[model samples]
Target chain A: MGCVRRSERIVRLTRHLVDHPGTALSLTEMAEHYGVAKSSLSEDLAIIRSVFEQDGNGFLRTQLGANGGILFEVDVSTTREQEIMAEILAQLSDPQRILTGGYMFITDVLSQPQILRNVGKMFAKLFAKEEPDVILTVETKGIPLAVITSEYLNIPYVVARRDHNWSEGPSVSTNYVSSFDRRIQSMSLSRRSIVQGARVLILDDFMKAGGTIKGMIALMEEFSATVVGTGVFMATAEPSEKFISSYRSLVTLAHMDEMSGSVVVEPGNYFTERM
Target chain B: MGCVRRSERIVRLTRHLVDHPGTALSLTEMAEHYGVAKSSLSEDLAIIRSVFEQDGNGFLRTQLGANGGILFEVDVSTTREQEIMAEILAQLSDPQRILTGGYMFITDVLSQPQILRNVGKMFAKLFAKEEPDVILTVETKGIPLAVITSEYLNIPYVVARRDHNWSEGPSVSTNYVSSFDRRIQSMSLSRRSIVQGARVLILDDFMKAGGTIKGMIALMEEFSATVVGTGVFMATAEPSEKFISSYRSLVTLAHMDEMSGSVVVEPGNYFTERM
Candidate 1:
């Protein structure tokens, strides 16, 4: 890189960590790339780590061993997380989001890349502690959220398709009832997508009765994968009892009135799960 | 963000710009955030900008107006881009990816976060010049690619679903013949996802005969949007002529023999589109 000055080195080092979140960068290799000594690189990393802490952007973790290296962990500050949730709550509370069946339309919110990115950061910050090997989500809306969360956590994600494409080779699928329509629908995942005994984190954009999430859990079972944790952008408060007993949501859709064009939202179980 | 020291301020400033690519950061606001003088902040930015140049990671452009400020433009170097494309070629040539009916099973590859991220960088670098207001992709496989590209370009994206979901409120749909099966199938997008007269770029994971891409262009027309460009991950060589005349692809699928598990791939029009 030929970045000699301390401030220059700090900027490059910080950019590397920022680009590859959750992935470890070999300190020895980094030193070589910067044409600096190991001790010098270590000092540079210290400055970068402290900057991360002071800014409350995230935290850095360094491991010592053969396969060990420096890693950047995504951690959203409590105040910033609250702000993100409040923003999402406001978007969801828009009366125009109320649909014909009182179903709150959220496609617009998820379509905005910035909102999707921030939402991913929140989910990643909350579920990263689980150390899931991979993320799993159903197709359609969940794909973007899963992709962003995977980016933040530096983990690979597999999307379970709404149907099995035979051209895709053999697939493992399970039928589940759709709470939104009260009908049976099948979801599928490629047989090679996940290996056996992998720790999995299931994420989705929204949940009502958790039928889709529950279906994903079952699909994970087919691969003999462990469901370490589950996260959702929002869930219905009325589904007090859901198909799945375990999951953390960022916001709760408390009430909706199509005729009056009213929608209500509150902090989800995320409050209880995280602080 | 009370970053006092020069290295510390550089680290935090670089982090914010890295987090928000294509979005301008006002120097006055950044100066206030770091509790530093405007002159000092500008000096710090110069250092950061030079570092970014030295690393060939990207470029920083500063605007001189009210709605203008410093912005990071994602630029993948020629050497790094070649490496990325070569890596993808090797991954795609794996005989195991040859599925039934000579179809390639790339779902597993699109699932990898690192590959997906790099692919996004390449596409963003190629199409960012179009300055498209929003990105468009179809449901299922194309969502992750679009989402990642959206992140790099710092623009919003909308996915057209394979079928209509009334829960999403009113939507616009068009029927197209599926290239894989030659069967008529419909794709849809929420009516409110895009505004009239917006510039759009269409992206997809794979294309054969370009039926779906054609559908997306048609849908854009329905919204009174202009199609600035179209990009695809891979396109089949056998089609020779596709439904869409103007589009770019990263890799060309030369041959796939399911019986012998022999697959071949060539670099796509990305080379011609770039240097």
Candidate 2:
């Protein structure tokens, strides 16, 4: 390979780290790939790290161990996170998104790459130290959020299903009461979806009463997996008594008035979790 | 508010384009944001574009008009895509992934961020010219694939539900025959999920007979939307006569010996589409 300039190498390195978030890259390999000296590579990485931190994009972690080299950890600053939450709050407060039930239609926000990326970064940041082996979520709406969070964390995610299909083969099933209607429901996860003793972080787009999250925890238990932490994009505040008390939410739905068509939303525990 | 180095500008520019794929960026705003001259910004963009294309990460598009600017178009090369497909094929070929009813348990692969990102980039590349207004898919398995595709395309996606919930407000419903069991089933999308005359690309994790994609198309028509294209991560080769003739798939399951626990998989129309 031809020798590349520092500017070109930095751009490519930045792209590489961004693409493979939370993945460690060896200096020896990168140096050989770029046909540059190890010292030069280290200096270049330092510059990249400085820019990433100054821009508030993320942190470039370097471990001195033999297996460690460089890892990009996504970090969304509290101020920027608050700004994103405020924007989401405004979107949720739209009257048209109000349904007959207390549900706020946020499919639009969850589907937007820009919004989801930021939200995922926030979740990844909150659980950065958790070093989860995998991410977990129930099927349907939470898929996107879970995917994005795992993407940022550089881990795979597993989805538990409400309906058991014969195509999935043998599976473990668990029953949990629906917090919304207090009805008993069952969710299943394929035996192969998760390995034994894996640490998992639970993520969801919306949480009304935490029934689904509770079910995910129960399902994780079947795999002998440890629940490292839980995060949600939004949660209803009406149910002061949640099935699971230990969880973080990006936004809180304080009040929803169907007759008058009004809604109240505030930044969730995500803001206070750090404190 | 101060002068910035070319290396610094390029790093930030690359991160910006990669983060907001397929979204056009105004050079004026970017230049102002970077505190650089328009000429300098153009030069920086040119360098970034060359490196991106060389790395086979994506393409940086430049438009020159009142509403013109640079746009990042994610493009995974045939060679890179083949490597990704081969990796996925190996994973799927495992007998452990085989389940009853001839279904390959792919929740792990679809939930994998690295693999899903590549698959999503491939879909975005195949339909790059389609300029889909939105991406669509049925809930459960396909949600992650659809979300990743839309993320690469920098657009929002909608999920159709197998069953409707009052929390979604008004929705449009359609019934289609299941290609696997040849059974009739109903799927619905929120009324606001899609708008009139929108261009949509359907995405899914696996396609047996493409009944789900067909149902999605029918639902899109109710909203007066056009189905520009459809893509799937994997599709079975059985039932040679597919319900939909115009679609793309990454991997094809040519055969499966359930008793012997052997399987055959190869690149799908995704390879032939370019030809």
Candidate 3:
């Protein structure tokens, strides 16, 4: 390779740090890799560190000592994560996204990583005391957060499908009232999926009537599993007659009036009250 | 408050660090809060730093300058994040969780904080070059990831609902094949929701045939939105016919044989090849 300039060296070094995890590289090592002088490499690393910190991804880390080098840290904060989630929830709360079927468009919100991280952190912290053996949620909207939370807790998650498959030997079915559609729908889970007596943390994206959560709680009981705790991304505080009780919400939909262009949302009480 | 012990003081100090992001506290101040000596506090901080680093959450940063104190750097690596994601995929790939509907119980996997953090970083890195204006995905499974990615990119995400609501004016509808169900399903998006000519990134949880992806792409085109890139959490490499031509996958499902109790998955080529 031909000679690389100082700026190019900085970008390459930053990208390398991003690609590698935990391992730190010394100034001399980086200098040799880029065919640059140690002094020049030091300057380049300074610029790279500033840029990585500016990006909020936490990619470049510096250590001081004889064996010290540059390490990449991938951690992001709970609040920063929460800000992203609040934005998505804000979008989802838009009345325009609500369909006649009473379902809100959730794909955009669920697919994003920052929001998920914050939401997952919230779940992990809430359940930290419970120390559930597994996380549980009903398909398909609940799957994203449940999966992320399980990973954080270092536990497995099991999904309760809306319907049974031919491949599943046998399944237990239950009735759930749809909060959005306001209709009774059937939910099912394979008999062999969840381990009996496992402490399960139930999660969902949105809960209005709490029907699905109730159904899952019932199913867990049927499987001899304990419902340790319940969590939801968004919950409507209006509906008083919920199927499941004692659940935590990240954000609550306080009010929405499309005709008046009025919508109100606030961080749920869980943040302050939980700890 | 009564005098707190050294260990209690350390836990309280760490909690404070976790709560106050971007703010550093001096060792003297921390020691004063707990009524402990500066040297005792130093030892306590050392233990706190070790615990934080061991968790892979971040680091307890110390500075010796006049204005410097101790700060926590919540940094994680892309590789470590990816490793967590691979672990989640492995859990999701459990054959016992796959129901007859050809769906895996993945709700728990999506609800994790660390996984979401990694996912957000992945999208930020992927879209750093293009810097798309908005993220788009169809309802339900895709919402969590889309929300997380949008948060990292600091962009808004738009969800195309599967059906139209009365609040939304007129919606454009399209027919798409469901890869899991292997059936034709109708997908719809409100015309007023998306901005025309804006660059959009489409995201989803699983892609077998890419039919829904095509529908979203079409919906984007209808609004004159540009499809900058597409992404999915899991994609089946087989079934060559797909709705979208180019996309990135976090994990690839190579094969599934129920009778033989064989299911194989590996990290997607996207990680190894991309920056």
When sorted by TM-score, best at the front, the candidate numbers are 1, 2, 3
lDDT of 1 by residue, A236-259 (tens): 898699999788988889988877
Best by lDDT: 1
lDDT of 3 by residue, A129-223 (tens): 68688787886667667866765565667677676645445778888777666777887776766777889889988888787788888788788
Per-residue C-alpha lDDT of model 1 across residues B238-260, encoded as one tens digit per residue: 87988998999999998888787
* Model 1 ranges with Cα > 4 A deviation: A1-4, B1-4
Alpha-carbon local distance difference test for all models: 0.87, 0.85, 0.67
Docking class of 1: medium
- Which window of 10 residues has the lowest lDDT sum in candidate 3 chain A? A1-10
For residues B159-257, what per-residue lDDT tens digits would candidate 2 score against the true structure? Answer: 888888676878899999877778899998889888899999898888987787888888888999999988888888887878887888889999888
State the fraction of real interface contacts model 2 keeps: 0.79
Model 2, residue A85: displacement in angstroms? 1.5
lDDT (10s digit) by residue, model 3, range B1-275:
22124333543455446533334688777677667689877766676666556545556667577867986555455657667776777786787765444545554466554565567657656665575888887866676677666655656676666655443457787777776666878777767557778998888878887888988887777788888888888888788667677888888888777666667787875676663
TM per candidate comes to: 0.97, 0.96, 0.58
Ten contiguous residues with the weakest lDDT in model 2 chain A = A1-10
